[model samples]
Target: MAATRIWSIKGRLDSVINYVTNPEKTDGGKYTDTELQALADVIDYAEDEAKTHNKVYVSGINLSPNIARDQMVMTKLQFGKTDKILAYHGYQSFLPGEVTPDQAHEIGVELARRLWGDRFQILVTTHLDKEHLHNHFCLNSVSFVDGKKFRGGSKAYWQMRAESDKICAEYGLSVIKNPGKGKNYAEWKAEHENRPTVRNQIKDELDEIIKCSYTYEQFWKILKQRGYAVKRDVKYVVLKPAFSQRYIRLKSLGKNYSEEAIRQRIIAARNGIRDLDKPKSDYNAWLNKYEPTKLHGFKALYFHYLYLFGKIRKKETPQRVSFYMRDELIKFERYQKQFRFLYDNEIETVEQLTIFKENVENKIDEMIIRRSKLYDKTDSKTEIKTINAELRELRKNLRTCNNIFIDAERIREHTEYVARLEKEANEPQKQQIKDYVIG
Candidate 1:
């Protein structure tokens, strides 16, 4: 099957022309790369053609092609008075070993003509450098006859794919029955390489965050705190995680992780309702098995101590949990990590944890102050490098401290909220009513 992908080329007309007509790919001016053996009449190469008298033509309207970077610029100037788009580029690739280079080229030319022959001026080139034979089409965005611009959208892409599939089937080539979902070229390449894609990483992070968050706002806040830059688009949310250069569309993740679905998940979780889409966790089971005697302050601390000393037996654990913590044993292992962090730091009390957090903050502040002084005093690249190295170490240390501090604070808040709920539950109905009204 021949897969098709297309996207608009937005920028200066000259640059686009140069890229499509690169001399190296054109066989050093022999033009063997092209399918039709010659560029279309509408595309002019007068200076390069010498005998053409330095004239460019777009369907009988002659102009200087060389002086203005060839027919692309002329076309842009002619139709650009009404439209903003410059050109469109598309790729049609045949599966490896399915078709010969010559066959692929012929099919590509036919496909291009079928798609944009009447309106746009197109150049089709078959590239043989890759394992899979492919055709590249550089089509003018504006119409030659009426100056109408090509309006591309989701419908246009679907139509293009349908045409391609029909053409491939005509040549006795296999066609993809269900193309399924679309992915950009980079994502496709990364998946083929078995690397974790940005979308997958973001989805994993979102799943973890949703488990801890009680509301939409809290979910957003948690993502931001974890170094993601969230942007609200018209129909979907976009996220640019730390160290990433591009923003990922949430809708592109999948139907299950859409913005509306995530919002519904948050609402359901807040109302104590479980969603089938969400994975079940053993947290409630763990709580029930290890119910606290006192439903007041220090419950979190007491549990941490029990967890740290291996007092919570594995036999008492739940059978199933979320995928990340797949079973009771795995969940206990995760708790052990947190328990060790607290125990190794000697953070047995909330007061001690608070002091430890303050010390870390002060250390971070001291490093920042030192770095600022270094920046002011040094202009040498070597000195700057040394300063940056030191700063990076400090930042790493600070991240560890931040994670511990957040966990400790969460424990404190959760324990206090549970204590308040228990206190209310224990009071008489009339006293509870009076308490609710008092303040």
Candidate 2:
């Protein structure tokens, strides 16, 4: 199956252009030396799935791929549509082992042609750096034909999906029969990381309110009093929490949170029947179910960080997360990478991480000197290429090590901040205890 996503690029158009065509970084995330070497060892990378040794194939529709960025910029300038969005970057990713790199590129080119080939300028690149073959399209927001901006929204995405499905069907490829609604990157990332969002918070609130509500009307009243604006519809009930700008449909929450489900839950509560559908509320139950492993070094720090950020024990009932803590969710992915780097290298402490980084740097410097000498040779091309590849991996590792130091320090600071907040929150209870003891 081919999955697709498109997002707008606001700043520099060349950044995205250089990324897709450039060989250094294909997919996001820092790669280990092993992966880099594996990519480098493949000396005969095909140019297309069709006929060349170029592992990646890049094509420009209505423009040259070489200067696609400049052309896109010139079009934007001609139309005076350069103020907001510069370009649109979209990707069509195929399932691994399903399609060859050439076939994937052909499909990508066809899809782009059917969608935007006539009106807008597009740069289609098929990147084979990863196991799954995917195509990246850098589309100019401003159309070259009419100088009109490509109106991008849900409609555009659906249209792209429909065309992609049609093309994939023609190619005898599997398509998503029932694709879920596309969420923005931030929301999707937050959900993936198990960080609490407005939707989750609202679900948690409903879980609590449903227990005490004996009637459907009582439920709506309780929800409104709890700062949720209720909009009853013939088919679906929608709710807007005080903190959320958009109204969320009840059905969107889950099958359990649907209007009929809510009414059934109320009836069950009225009959003194405990809800089997209720959230797993007992922390002890979670502890008994899964034995906690003792973590140390960066791994332990990451666990603690996730815990304090309200992402550690997600199986239990959701808690009302502080608005301030939501911002830290973005760092969860970075911290995960740092943890993996430390664990994979077997570096336990900050000092160990420092030493490891130094070792990588020393190796890099030595390789650079060797590479320089090999460059002077007329017959050392193979050895020089291998050395250059190894050097790039070393430099990438060095950069990752530097980032680990900064991230480790941030984790420490956040840990200390959480401790202070807990202490402040307990001050009143401590004062009450002292008064009782004195009395």
Candidate 3:
């Protein structure tokens, strides 16, 4: 599960940008050499000390050439330097629900302190006045206290958020809710899937066919029924659906399900023989489908792979895969108590969650079995008991899931940025580039 625990901060960009551009803006309102020195010092310190995964450069200042120069003119940042050393955006994030801005800012400072304790060269700026919610994190990019290289990429960014959440929780602040997968790429993918897409429609149809058809003709007939055009030839069949005109053959499915088998499955399905082949494997059945237990199993597999690859250092495995903890179990019951308020009215939210949790529990049992298999032969009851206890703890945490912040703007912003940049490349950028390069 990718991390999505984002810590977002916003500050006066005008002030900060000005300060960065012109050293004169450093003092109070007017920038000064001292302020510039401070920001540079912070960056240097953070880079040296913060144990970072990657250095990420993100910014929201859309640098229109005309306006860009004006901004720089105000800031006095190498006014005539045309060649951009770097094109980047400055941004901050944590998971969907973690700590708020105040807490997140503090966490940034804490990270600096942890990496370079007592060496203060960190500044958190908010860009609230503008039409965006963003933050400027100017640190030394190194710490004097330690020599951990500051990494600022996606993974490091989330690690920062996770540490923030853990610390915030420790400090008694209202920690934002997170499902361990942190609101990273995977969550964005999930959200994107909810939107209308030709690809999604294709997947949906493919899934239906997977469950219903056992052979090529059966598959073809079903597709035709669902408004596809199919032509059978002597050697092979060509399918021209409303969505595409791709030619598919028996070889496409797999080696075992050859042309002969593909046709056979279709025939069997057409004949209404339910058991076309032996039986679908557990994995094949769950492919392109969503099931809580299966999902939990997948999460288990993912972490196992990550651990094996040494992506993250091994800690006592998290008790809850769905981001639940023992402390919040009772609170969850209360939160959902409203649904039970009309138990007889019989809504199904609680029922669904109950089923999901049960499925998760079953997978945990499965996990134990798998663990036993993977490790050296030790079927000791004590070992099993310990695993079960951890499973229980995991169950308690996942029994109630929380993500306090319900809104997201980053994806939309990224989407717009991509579209606009693509458009610029398509239209106005061509002649400008030709002139700039040739002239």
Best by lDDT: 2
- For each candidate in the order shown, give its overall lDDT on alpha carbons: 0.57, 0.70, 0.37
Collision pairs in model 2: 46-53, 46-54, 46-55, 47-53, 47-54, 49-102
lDDT (0-100) at residue 83 of candidate 3?
Answer: 30
lDDT tens readout by residue for model 3, 210-314: 458766556666777766665666465445446443444434334434556656655665686655444322312212242324333223222222222121112
**Candidate order, TM-score descending:** 2, 1, 3
Clashes of 3: 65
| Model 3 ranges off by over 4 Å | 1-90, 93-120, 129-132, 146-208, 214-439
RMSD of 2: 14.8
As for lDDT, the candidate ahead, 1 or 3, is: 1
Judged by whole-model lDDT over C-alpha atoms, candidate 1 comes out at: 0.57
TM for every model, in the order presented, reads 0.33, 0.43, 0.27
Residues 1-439 of candidate 2: C-alpha lDDT, one tens digit per residue: 7899888989888899888766543423344655544433222222212233434366677786666778988988897788888889999999899877656776887789889988999988778777888899999999999899888888889888878877776554666544465244345546775655566667766877898897999999988887778888556677887777677778888889988888998898889988466464332332233222756777677666655544423432122334334445545555655666766787768888889988987786677566656644569868965875675467558767888778778778877776676677677889999999999
Worst 10 residues of 1 by lDDT: 318-327
Between candidates 1 and 2, the one scoring higher on TM-score is 2
lDDT score for candidate 3 against the true structure: 0.37
How much is the lDDT of residue 68 in candidate 2?
Answer: 78
